[model samples]
Target chain A: MTIKEKSEAIVEEFAIFDDWMDKYAHLIELGKELPIIDEKYKDESHLISGCQSRVWLHADYVNDNVVYTADSDAVITKGIISLLIRVMSDANPSEIYSSDFTFIDDIGLSTHLSPTRANGLVSMVKQMKLYAKALYLRAEK
Target chain B: MGFKINSIRNDFPVLSTKVNGKQLVYLDNGATTHKPMQVIDRISNYYMTENSNVHRASYNLSHIATDLFENSRKFIANFINAASYREIIFTKGTTESVNLVASGFSDIITEGDEIIITVMEHHSNFVPWQQLCKKNKATLRFLSVLKDGTIDLSELLAMINSKTKLISITHISNVLGTINPVKKISEIAHNNGVPVFVDGAQAIAHANVDVSEIDCDFYCFSGHKAYGPMGIGVLYGKEEWLNRLSPYQYGGEMISSVNFKSTTFNELPYKFEAGTPNVAGALGLERSLRYIQDIGLDNIFKYEDDLLQYATKKFENIKGVMIIGNAKSKIPVISLNIEGLHPYDIGILLDQMGIAIRTGNHCAQPLMEALELPGTLRVSMALYNTKEEIDLFADALMKAIDMLT
Candidate 1:
């Protein structure tokens, strides 16, 4: 399935269950389906601090577009990270910069996060974009 | 003997209430405690009858308000066994208190000075010192905790030297419940001419906190954690040191004179309180403190200690539930994880059963990383908690474990 189709399917599953307890299994399953990232990028430089669940994110700048690979220690957070990578990977720096992540609310899973956790999520995405922006800016320089 | 657990429950009316048809067994007291009726009445009465700005007013209402505000300061000084009322400086809460010290000392703490804190500190104690060190080009080092959750004393002693300027620490582990050996640590710092600051946020309610007994340079605690009002906290500095540190904020109350060209700050405690203080909250805090005093802190501590012992035994009986932080000295906080379940899921399940617990890292993310766990369900205790409540919590946990595992 296409990334959009899989994302839509994930979004649809969220609607099918209101209780987080009921949705937890599906969320863990989502994490299970995420492809293992290459061993080369799994290092300290890509580590995200302040997460109870460990998250490592790496971006490869191939031909001016960003390809993202991510993993998390917690199954549910990994799933969320996979969903994030699928939506964000391969997007151009300008497109990623201009895009609104209101898809968080659209998918109806934003409320499941605590305010601090939501802030951390925004921070994580911001960092990924920052990595892309810096790489693009360096190339330009 | 007159106070059965149920009878004592009247002091906390929130316990009797139902949330989503579940009885609220609030085990999250270490996070923030519920207010007693005396505290509630005192706060409401301040707003309703004696509402006025203090220290600068002379009206009848203002006189009463001013008197009450000063009385609260005295009450806090007495509560913490400070030498005099001048030692206590009121701020918004523990975070504000720490920020006050960090900001105030920034001028004096030169680039080479070293600041020490512990691993178990809430971000309040850790971050302010970190920012202070970062700003001044100094070093921020932590006293690591043992596998059993006690402070690594040898490591702490080795780290302290002539260059070490301050030792900031938490009195009790909000997550681990391990009571640090502050007195011994204080002795080491003092011998080396380094001052220590104890974050008494979690300890004030659980145990007796004597500034003189600990002999630390500074101590801070929030009122909310001790069954007092929110938005009010105290910073206790030794008279000599408090006299030396400059003001953190520049404003009306904290200063003696502010002319067009320059300004002079007030003496000691007033030098720290910058704005109009939380008068009502202070009044409420005093009442709550008086209530605790009347109940007897030693008695309360013994009772909770017993309850902790009982709860620990019961927790050990449960299968696949790993109880974290087995320090030799601990309060009633029980941090545990049921295998194969997220801490959030355990908290949600417990919430559904009417038990309130903190599910996340409990604001000590570094400790969580050190423990190599996502998070643990923290069931912290207060004076009012009973063994029966723990039994209820354990039964709920057993059910949660069944569902999750």
Candidate 2:
């Protein structure tokens, strides 16, 4: 599925939960199912700063697509990271790079993307896009 | 003069608010405190009627502003029981106050001179001295904390010598809430011929601080942390030290006379305070201090201690909850970590329940490294907080843990 399709699906999934607690519970469940990055990539080189919780993100370019893997020490941050990875991963570099990821706001988790939140979700998204942009530029060259 | 919790709660307008459909339980007093109605009104009144550039104009408004501003210095000097108002040099806040002193010392500290600071100091206190030592080619030594988050006096005594030029310590640890023996430390430092600078940012509101009694060369605290306005802090120095140290900044108000070639500096307090000061902030701060005085620090201390004990007992029974900093002497601050859950997760969940707390290193990264933990959730209470609020927080914490687990 395309990034938009996956994000919409997740939004729909989240829409079923009327209460904030249920929404958080769903996020927690999703956090457990995150595509774990290799332990080797979980070092300082892969670490994303500006977060209260430690987040490490790794990206791989394969089959003309970018695949993302990430982890966070905080489960709520991890949950947010899981959603971001699910939305942006397995897409071409240009597609991942250009997407604004407005679904975060649509799903009422926009606060996580705010710089003040400092949960690394904002940094994670930025890093993901930067990686995709770098790959896209290299491919153009 | 009675400790009326309800009336005191009413004094703070923000306490009546709600967050996320629940009553707001503000427990992050360590970060900054909400201003009482009196402090708020004081600032508003200053801006409305007494708005003028102090120490400059000859107008009536300016005179009123100047008197209010100068009176704030005197009030603060008296509040901390300093020798005179000249000892009270107003700066931006505690961080700026520390920086001002550190900047002055940078010139005096020579090669091989040492500065001792505890590992539990906030970044504001830790960074300035570290940079000062580095720039002057001096040594920076850290006094390690014991298991219960208290420092051993023997270790401090052993660390000081002829080479030790200064010892900057916090009156209370922001993260651990351990109240250090500032008086004892000051005595030790003075005996060793080393000046002591106490960072009273955390202690100023929670306890009564007398700079003269402590006999520390320098003591500093932020106004906002103590029920006052932001952007105004006090740097209390001995008259001799204030005279000896050079100005931190050079500008309009801090100068006696200025020429194209050279400039002569102003007297104590004014020398450190350059440019147009935060006159309104100072007035607000003075009013807040007065409010505290009327309430009485002893009464405030007793009430907070009861809240701390009540909260501690509740958290002690919770499974997998580890309370950090079990120091015998502490204010109403508690830092805790769950067995497997992260502090950020707990903090976010608690916020949803309208319970505000501080998470992460609390700006004491070295302390976190020493403790071998990432960070912990901290709940710092104040005069406005109550046992009922603590009970609510404890319940929310358990629910958050259950959900996360």
Candidate 3:
């Protein structure tokens, strides 16, 4: 699916929950079900240190598409990472680079995305886009 | 006068507010406190009526502003039992206050000179000395913390020698809530002919601080942490020490006379205060200190101690909940982590439940390293917080844990 389509689907899924409890519960479940990254890539080289939590993100260019895997010490942050991965992973680097990811605000989880929150999600998103942009430029070269 | 919890809570207008559709239960007083209407009104009144640059002009408004600002210095001196108001130098906050002293000491410290600090110090107290030592080719020693998060004075004594020029320690550990024996530390340092500096950022609001009684050569604290306005802090030093050190910043008010050739520095306090000062912030801080005085620090100490004990007992009952700092002498701050849960997760979940707490290293990374953990959730209480709020917090924590698990 396209990045926009995948984000819209997740937003629709979140819309069924009326209260914060249900929304958070869904995030927690998603966190538990996240595709675990390889133990080797969880080292300091991939580490993104936030004041509140730590995130490790690894991306690869394969079959002319970008594949992303990530992890966080905080489950909520990991859950948010899972959404970003769902929307951007397995897409072309140009498609991933151009994607806005405004779905975070649309789904009412914008607070977690704030730079002040310092959960590493904001930095992780930036790192992901940077990876895509670098790969796209390299391929063009 | 008796301690009136109801009226005290009412004084803080933010207490009545709600968050996330639930009544707000603010337990993050360690970070910064909610200002009372008294302090708020004082600040607003200063900006409203008495807005002028102090110590500059001979105009009526400037004189009024100068008087108010100088009176605040006097009030703070009395509040901390300093020898004189001239010993109190105003700065932006505790960070700047510590940096100011550190900057002055850079000239005094030479190669192989030693400076000792505790592992439990906040970064504000830690980084300045570290960088100073690094720059000057001096030695920086850290006094280790015991398992109970208390400092071992014997270690401190062993670390001090003729080579040791200074000992900088926190009066209270911002992360561990360990209240050090400042008087004893000061005595130890003085006996060894070394000057001691106390970071009283956490202690000034929670406990009674008598700088003369402590006898430390230098002490500092932030006003925001003590229920006052931000951007205002106090640095109290011995008259001899203040005279011995060079000025940290060179600017307008800090000079007696200036020319292209050279300039003469101002007197004790103003020498350290360089720029146009935060006059309104100083006034607000003085007013907040008065508010604390009216409530009585003894009463605040007793009230907060009871609350800490109550919360500790409640937290101890929960399985897998580990209280990080187990010091016998602690203020109303508690750091804890549940088994198999990250502090960030707990902090986020608690916020959704309309509870505010502090998580992460609490800006004491060395202490966190010593404790061998990522971070712990901290709940710091103030006089305005009540038993009911604690009960609510306990319930919300359990619910958060349940949901996470």
- CAPRI class assigned to model 1: incorrect
- lDDT tens string, model 3, B160-214? 9899999999999888888999999999999999999999999999987999999
The worst-scoring run of ten residues by lDDT in candidate 3 chain B lies at B343-352
lDDT of 3 at B169: 95
Please give the range of 10 consecutive residues that has the lowest summed lDDT in model 2 chain A. Answer: A112-121
TM-score of each: 0.83, 0.97, 0.97
Q: Give lDDT tens digits, candidate 3, residues A25-111.
A: 899899988998999999999887553677888998888898999888888878888989999999999888888888888898876
Q: Which ten residues in a row have the lowest lDDT in candidate 1 chain B?
A: B1-10
For candidate 1, write residues A22-102 as lDDT tens digits: 665566677778887777777888788766556788888898888888877566677777778877788777777666666
Q: Residues B181-256, candidate 1, lDDT per residue (tens digit)? A: 8998899999999988898899888887998999988998999998899999899999998888888878978889
Docking level for model 2: medium
lDDT of 2 by residue, B210-327 (tens): 9889999999999999999999998999989888898988897899998899999999879999999999899999999999999999999999999999999999999999999999
Question: In model 1, which runs have C-alpha deviations exceeding 4 angstroms?
Answer: A1-52, A55-71, A78-113, A117-141, B1-3, B17-21, B337-342
Interface RMSD of 2: 1.7
